[model samples]
Target: MGIKSALSRPLAAYVVHRDRQWQREPVAAQLRLLRRLAATGAPTAFGRAHDLGALRTPADLARLVPVRDYEGLKPYFDRTQAGEADVLWPGRPLYLAKTSGTTSGTKYIPITRASIGNHINGARDALLHYVHATGRSRFLDGKLMFLSGSPVLEQHHGLATGRLSGIANHHVPAYLRRNQLPSYAANIIEDWEAKLDRIVEETLPEDLTLISGIPPWVQMYFDKLLQLTGRPIKDIFPNLNLFVYGGVNFAPYRAKLFESIGRPIDSIELFPASEGFLAFQDEPGNPGLLLLLNSGIFFEFVPAERFFEANPPRLTIADVELDRQYAVVLTSNAGLWGYSLGDTVRFVGLAPPRVVVTGRLKHFLSAFGEHVIGEEVEGALREAMTQFPAVEVVELTVAPRVSADPGQPSRHEWLVEFARPPADAAAFAGALDGALRRRNTYYDDLRRGNILVPLLLTPLPAGAFQRHMKRLGKLGGQNKVPRLSNDRALAEGLVENP
Candidate 1:
């Protein structure tokens, strides 16, 4: 065995053991972390303004600081960007993770020195947990490709600013540096298509074992590799075994990804954001991710249904109930107070605080009073894919289409990009529509009442989603097409009629 593989087993055991200490006492750990964050933020401008020093409990936090999204907190973020020390956190952030925002345009989220470890350790612990569970760490000896943003940072008012993935690239552990692939030059290529070509050239001859990225981009990489080598990914990289992915649900892409590889492989899901590394899949075959309670962040759950209410109840770890959907609010060491992460989650396990991300709070379909979430659409698509084994989807998005003509009925339109088009397209649509109706009572009611006709399925031309993303200048690097939108904006841009 290689030295790294041999050492990994003991390290995995130690990491898992250390993890369980907090896992077993989630509420206590979270409470302690919350108190610590409050105490740490006590001296900051935001802390003083929000009375952070007086916060003794989650209720105090909720009452004192209203939950704010990026726009709400932009002033504080701007102050930090202007090089104001201790405005939000203890000092100017170590780096600003620049991310695309809808309303706010470019967002610079603070990543403080103290909180950066959470991001790094969360990823490390995920791998260690896999190693601990499977006792198969040989992949560490081979080249590991992390398909990520350019690691190039630009100065933004004295703070080093870059994409979160790019910022993360700088912090990859020294031990894994030798095994990391595609080189720094390939990573910094600004144009994604050009970058993919460079990456393929660099890694094609190497012994690549593990590949990690957001799903769609990974799929794009797999496609490129197959195109270049004219071989299934399994044949190309015989040692390739694990896929680490985050940012989207993998179910819709699983069949296509495995088909591209010519075999099934182990995969890990992570719940990470600019704000914090919230959770990771701790066990194989479990859909729920274990929420990191002691990761320099304190979490609050507000019922997603009542999230827009002026005074929604913010429940802490001890108060959250299993199976209920909640909007995640957080107070972190980076000095975000009562910040809404915008993602909705459902708790599946209370003991270790395992959660499944349902969808974005703002990224749902409610155009016709039928509130269908990301989970429902993904579940429906997964069910349809299972039933139609031959149908392999590349990408898909849904949007509600309201007919201007009174005689015509309004309907949800699904624009699907297929790797292998279903032999019976109508049947596939029926299966998808049925699955959705089964999951959502409002959708079922609308269907039965004929207020909305059966969903319209539009088979998009090959690379339709990619073309649209390219047009929008979001073709790669942590960008993803929303599963469903309330209006026809994304759908209209994605494809022409028929």
Candidate 2:
């Protein structure tokens, strides 16, 4: 490895900074820079802490900044592109990643050269980490599949495409070109059904050693693969060894990947963003995830318990504790400083602080003021399914509905699927609901008060995830499934049948 000083820019600085941070858990110099950045980010948030110049210790980083979601930074982004003083960090960035945000619209996330470097390098490093973990030198055999959205967007002001941050996997690196399944091969975001046809038609080959993307997208590919071919996955991709996934939890979709594929492979979970690739599943057999601390960004965590508190402790890389769930935050050199991304994570064990994704800090249901998260629901579903390990919970989404009565509160209605379902539905749903209530007291109270009735379970129409995937134009990737849905359209459509 050699230094490309000519490529020195935001990305270079970020990679360098990340390496330094890893060698030593954030040093005093880095802490000072962080304090100044946090102070600026704080006022941008809800807090009023200012004028404290000399931030000497890690404790200062722990001081609470008024919680600010991505919405708070929109103004800064607008000003930056306008050639005005970019209020957020202070730079004219390179390009932006078009991400589907929490507010139900496409979010154009700014990315500097640094952000781009982090994403590419982080992904490469993550792949390499997987290789090391599995003790394999070469990726099993054939092409690498990417299940992502149409990356062809408006041409970037500087050069080629504005979709680089999200779709760069399809381009940028020459190494990826030899074996690539650009899911959006039609040169457009075609209709969902047509798109899946393209995906299915291209992926039928058996040379692929690894398949990667969002879990839903991966599941979608398999559904089409199974339906069109009518063969077990082993018959399709006999050489497949890794089912690399990210963007959401894998526990719920675990059975689908392992059972439907009907073969053995690594169902790995990773934490990546438009900002950068970030963390990945590091330990083998354990399958527990760890941050490539030296990847390309700095990391931070806000104490999970402070989730609703007026003030919460922020954990610097130095202060982060193992085994405790916390809110994830980052400060990549892409001009994003001390940015809180609103994802929840927990340390799996100490030693090197192996972490497991707890859940999304945002993206939860609290209709009756009870915070019901993805992790809680998935845990309950997985535990209940363990009673019948032979079956898997393919695609299950929950919606919070309040009953139409004076004192009634909200309840959860679930839509679930199984490859070959078990004989009993009533017992499974009951057991799942019980596990949920036991884990979350708010859920128990809701049921007790009739605020929420016991969980309603609906066996979806055959191939629901696949149907949604086809409708959504999902291709091959870890991104196939519609992970969370608030409305009951998918569930209700099934109720009339099962």
Provide the overall lDDT of each model, using Cα atoms, as 2-decimal numbers: 0.92, 0.62
lDDT of 2 at 246: 78
State model 2's lDDT.
0.62
TM-scores for the candidates: 0.99, 0.80
State each model's C-alpha RMSD to the native.
1.1, 5.9
Mark the regions of model 2 whose C-alpha exceeds 4 Å error after superposition.
1-67, 83-91, 156-166, 170-172, 183-189, 308-310, 404-410, 445-451, 465-498
lDDT of 2 by residue, 1-498 (tens): 112212323343454445445445434444655655554444332123332233334555444323455675566555665654434443456666766566746656677654566676666655555454454634533666666556665644442334442356544476456566644464244454566677777778637767777676677677788888899887787777777777777777777777768966865666777666667665566756656555445567888668667666667666777666788776655546446787888777544456777677656667776777777888888788888676676677777666777666456877777766767888888888999998788878878887677777767766766665555444333333443455665555445444
Q: At residue 52, give the lDDT of candidate 2.
A: 28
Q: Which candidate's TM-score is highest?
A: 1
How high is the lDDT of residue 80 in model 2? 60
Q: State in Å the error of residue 278, model 1.
A: 0.7
Q: Count the backbone clashes (under 3 Å) in each candidate.
A: 0, 12
- Candidate 1 regions with alpha-carbon error over 4 angstroms: none
Please provide, for model 1 over 375-469, each residue's C-alpha lDDT reduced to its tens digit, 9 standing for 90 to 100: 99999998998998888999999999888787988999998999999999999999999999999999999999989999999999888888889
